[model samples]
Target: MATATFHQSIVSFASPSSTISQCGFKIDSSLSFTSKKINFCKIKAMASVSYNNTLLSPSKTIPDNTLKKPNEAALILIRHGESLWNEKNLFTGCVDVPLTEKGVEEAIEAGKRISNIPVDVIFTSSLIRAQMTAMLAMIQHRRKKVPIILHDESEQAKTWSQVFSDETKNQSIPVIPAWQLNERMYGELQGLNKQETAERYGKQQVHEWRRSYDIPPPKGESLEMCAERAVAYFQDNIEPKLAAGKNVMIAAHGNSLRSIIMYLDKLTCQEVISLELSTGIPLLYIFKEGKFMKRGSPVGPTEAGVYAYTKRLAQYRQKLEEDSEVICS
Candidate 1:
């Protein structure tokens, strides 16, 4: 077999001093094919005025009661676990599908990976697969806080689902389901097998259909079109929570996530073309002082420097391990 070599694209910065903290999340970084370093751009800092896209202007003042401790701001993004379509090598797109057995296991494992992190809010696409991933991952959270889906569909629904006691509300995380966070519409390819599609269309054509930034697949959404909605939702809904210093976890599909990542990392059309994500893996970001610092996922209990940013994560990890040992014993 011929050995295949791969290259890691590095995002370029004007200078080393240009930390993500100083610049708004809209990074001025560009991908360099020859570079081996991994570069990340933060989401453009929130502004008083909305950008040309669907972003709405943030409130000028946060209520005194709304201010959380600065260190509490964190963000976690996870692509949902494998679905039946994924197991069958089909393009899932926006079709509402359930997880496969392997996907259920993946969701459980994903929960363990971020068991120590604090999650004050949850966001997911209004699809079963994404919803299942978020709920299953929360199973191992050290906080042991239950996740309650918020039902704000109507005044009646809201009133019916309201918790009478404040204590109960405080103990649970709100999981908000939104269609804007759903996966890219895969159009006519929704149930088709990937191999067959590639066979029908040439491999290169299929690759372009799958990976190109602006080219949509046979009436499906292109990455650019997906970003118009996904990133907009993040700016409008998710970022406000982070701006208020709340830790948020978003469970969504691959293309939707890639769209948000493109905004956060400031990937250009060419750069985002090759971006890919693995299912059930959570990526972390630290939000403080109105900026986001990308912290790659924690792969193990003792991964050095991973826990240094948050004291709560380290303490929770220790407690989780002790609890696990007790269960085994």
Candidate 2:
């Protein structure tokens, strides 16, 4: 084995082939460094992920390429970046809102984290914030394929938007927007300042409406009511794609995503009540053999767990690394 150590090293990796029109960098843009600026005799050791290839239990890991089966695919769930209403501390249920500047940056950063991972299709709520988050995140993907929305409202819309060339179709990804994935409706509370509403309605009442599993705000959808539509759409529309070995990414609202996650993890009603998700952070899962296994989130491509445990993922990373070297050269 070649012995190499990097007290500090810098390198950049890019992959154009994986993207449409050969416009992509399969590696994080931050990885680029001037080779002349650093020296390495050899690369001796690499950090191993726990349970994981390193035989350490730092993190619960996928066992021995348990995801090597062709049926296995990656499922990623991300809450939409912060919206304008979020910045204002207002209740933003199904109302269509846009992302704030910080929200846009969050989405871009999120894209960098999963740049190396494969994403064949995307799903987002019908709201503009969720769709914007999805589009912004894809802009950072090492795979630079355009994510075009599928128009299913009318048959003519679909027919009119169809790509005639198979190659163009192959290079593009379909983004499906579903109203079922929208945030839990806040009814009369929409646009109301959360703090003011809490003050007026009493903190306890607001808490029940927000955190209680089945309680609803005046004419609004409760967590349970939201889940009824969200989870049903997931099981009906999303799971089938996973079964077909397609990598799927979903950009949605907090409550809707929480509901979908609750279904995936089989959480109890009480348990789901306590679940909370931060905006713009992605949670990963492996879908195989009609089962879903949470993989936690990958913070970056350099993270050991990102490429370890799954042989196929490791191989994909290896290929990306090779392509990256060629790019830097």
TM-scores, all models, native as reference: 0.74, 0.73
lDDT by residue for model 2 over 66-178, one digit each (tens)?
33446677898888877888888888887777888988998888888877667888999888888998988888887688899998879999899888988898778899999
lDDT of each: 0.67, 0.66
The 10-residue segment of model 2 with minimum total lDDT is 14-23
Alpha-carbon lDDT of model 2: 0.66
User: lDDT tens digits, residues 1-329, model 1?
Assistant: 00000112111111000001111111112111113222222234333223322223333433223223543467889888888878778887777778889889988888888887778889998888899999999987877889999888799999999888888887899999987788877656777888888899988998887888767777666676667667778888987777655689999988888888766644456656666677788887776555455666767433555545555444433443343222100
Q: Residue 6 lDDT in model 2?
A: 10
> Which prediction has the highest TM-score against the true structure?
1
